[model samples]
Target: MSATTYALGAFILLAYTLEAITGFGSIVIALSLGALLLPIDQLLPVLVPLNICMTGFLVSRHWRLIDRRLLLGMILPGMAIGTLAGYLLLPYLDEVSLKRGFGVLILWFAGRELWRLQRKAPAREHTPNWVMRLATTAAGICHGLFASGGPLLVFALATTTLDKARLRATLVSVWFSLNSLLTLAFLLDGRLVPALPQVLLYAPLLLVGVWLGERLHRRIDERHFRIAIYALLLITGTLLLVGP
Candidate 1:
């Protein structure tokens, strides 16, 4: 295989593994890194299906841990609005500026996370409803527009009182619903079929990565789990900011 193909394989492997371990981030990791090898127009179609499968697997596997209250009350409304608006606005949106703005948002959140880590402050026992609404709304818009919405939602979830398991499970549930919608949207628009062959080609490596990530997930402590998340946000955000 060519070097670019090899890099693509490697990126998918790592990205899927991270998603399996962390609950929500395959697209964020893949798109941020894969953009180096292929244009977003091509990379997004391939990654979207893969993201749904990954999140679906995790959600099913961890179904009992999901916070149904949060999912129904706080996330769905914003997601519904954002998805519709995003689908309608996709053709007219200024993608380059939007991506840079996305990067700035992520970096700002990452900075806040780092500050919290430095101060050793405890996670908040109660994240306000207004904050949850805003985060879910922004995540929905990003999900609808860019398919890279996990970090913003993750940032919001990380602040709550949920333990690592609940947090990961809940995030997976969100992705499952959002990505399912995205996958269907892509299907109706005829973006899914042409991408399937490439997605299948990478399936073996992706499964292997998921298996490895599951192993790592069991070993991660709470502190290290948050650290892993922050690391991903920092890397993905910087890449989005600097990439074309």
Candidate 2:
């Protein structure tokens, strides 16, 4: 496998494992490394379905913890609009610009989270509705355009005081719904449809990745090790932006 493919497969193994142990890490880790290793063109379709599949399992696995009303009220609708807009803008955005833009968002959000964790302060102590709306809209666009937007959405929602379990459920529900719809749009466009088979080819690897990530997450959670996954996200996003 190519270095890029190795990175992607390895990421799936580890990220999925963490999510299995602790739901919150699923989207955050999946998309962060995904943006770096896989070209967004290939990355979006491949990852989105797996995300929906994995996150859906998470929703079922943690059924009691999900916040249904929140998904209905904020994320779903925002994603609908965002995805539509993203599809419209897709032809106009070059890969480098899109990846770079995504990278910046990830890094910025990750930095903020790490800082709050340091100060022993609540990340969502006073986050506003506008922030959530902004996050959902932007994330929807990212997902529609790149099939990866977990870190941004997860970070935005993580502001709430919901416990880790609830946080994971909420994030999963939102992403699954939004990504499902985005996939539909991609089908309509006929651009990413051809890649579905390749996505399936990687399924087993993705599953393995999730399993590995779960193991890592368990160790980290047991030690109460919570660090921002965004530093890498930002750096990658910047790299994408400053591409050769």
Candidate 3:
């Protein structure tokens, strides 16, 4: 393999491990960093399926913790509609524009999250239902467009009543379902076949990431880990926005 391939594998391992711990952020982190090495179009097909594999495992293990009512009643419907709409529109979008726009979005999210963390603001008791609905729907559109919608969904869910375990379980379930849809879309559009080899090549790395992350999830301080993650994201967003 070339150096770029090795670098991408490292990024994949790091990203998925984080997701295993947090139940979200694999694609956003992986895609953002990987896009610096490879094109977004190529990376999404591979990253989405890998996400399915990881999240599928998580969902199966934590199915009992999922808030089914919230998922079905509010999150799923909005995301489903938005995802399909974004998928349909993907072919018309310009790749460079997409990358830069995604960078800006990530930057804003990371900066806001870091700011919140720095101030140690208490999470809100309730996010208005309409706001959550809008965020999830928007998250779906982002997933369809970039396969990196966890930030929005996470932001929306942070204010909810679910505790850490339940929230992580629910989020992974969301990724498993949405990414499956995205995988099918890729199959129908003739993109999956071409990406299969790369997907297969990285399977072991994904498993290792999950194993390590699950262990870390049990030991790490949540606040500090989050601070580190957003810090990395802040730098990544800067690179994506300015790098050639």
Candidate 4:
């Protein structure tokens, strides 16, 4: 591997570890940083499938903890529509524009979450159902475009009734399903085969990340963890906005 490849591996491990702990950020974190090293188009084929593997493992183990009603009844329909639309539109979009737009969205959500955390504000008493629906659909579009929609989805879900465990499990399940669809899209469009070697090469790093993150997940304080995640997102968003 070249120096850049090694750097990407480090990013992959770090991102997947965070995802194992939180269940929704592997792609966003990895893609944001990795884009600095490689084109997002090349990265997406490898990263999206890798995410399916990581989230699939989490979903299998924690399947019982998922909120099936929310998954099947509310989230999937809107997200499915948005994902298809974004995927179909991707070829016409400018890469730099996509990254900048994504950066702005992440900045908004991360800034808001950090502020709320600082104030020690309580969770919202009621998030209108329509708002949540819109968030999920928008999240799917982001996912389809960049495979990095966790922050938006998380922003919406953080206001819901789910506790930490259920939230993590449910989010992982969502990723597993959405990423699987993305993988299929890549396969049909002839993107997956060329990326297969890179995917296999980095697979072991994901295992290491999952092990470490699972251990840390049990020991870390939730509040501190959120601070760390949001802080990272804030940095990532800024980098995406300013990076060449």
Number of the top TM-score candidate: 3
Q: What is the C-alpha lDDT of each candidate?
A: 0.77, 0.67, 0.91, 0.88
Expressed as tens digits, the lDDT of each residue in 1-244 for candidate 4 is 6999999999999899989998878988888788777888899999999988988999989999999999998888878888888899899989898788878877887789889989988877677889989988998898889887788888777767887789889999988998999999999999999999999999999899999889988998867887887798899889989987
Candidate 2: misplaced stretches above 4 Å?
A: 1-3, 18-38, 209-219, 222-228
Q: After TM-score superposition, what is the CA distance of residue 55 in candidate 4 from its true location, in Å? A: 1.0
lDDT of 3 by residue, 124-225 (tens): 778889999999999889988998888888888887888878988998999999999999999999999999999999989988998999899899998899
**Candidate 2 on 20-66: residue-level lDDT in tens?**
65554554466667766666666666666776777776677777888
Worst 10 residues of 3 by lDDT: 120-129
Candidate 1: deviation at residue 206, Å? 2.7
* Clashing pairs for predicted structure model 4, backbone only: none
Q: Give the top-scoring candidate (lDDT).
A: 3
* Model 3 clashes, total count: 0
User: If scored against the real structure, what TM-score would every candidate get?
Assistant: 0.87, 0.80, 0.98, 0.95
CA error at residue 215 for candidate 1, angstroms:
1.2
**Which regions of candidate 3 fall more than 4 Å away from where they truly are?**
none
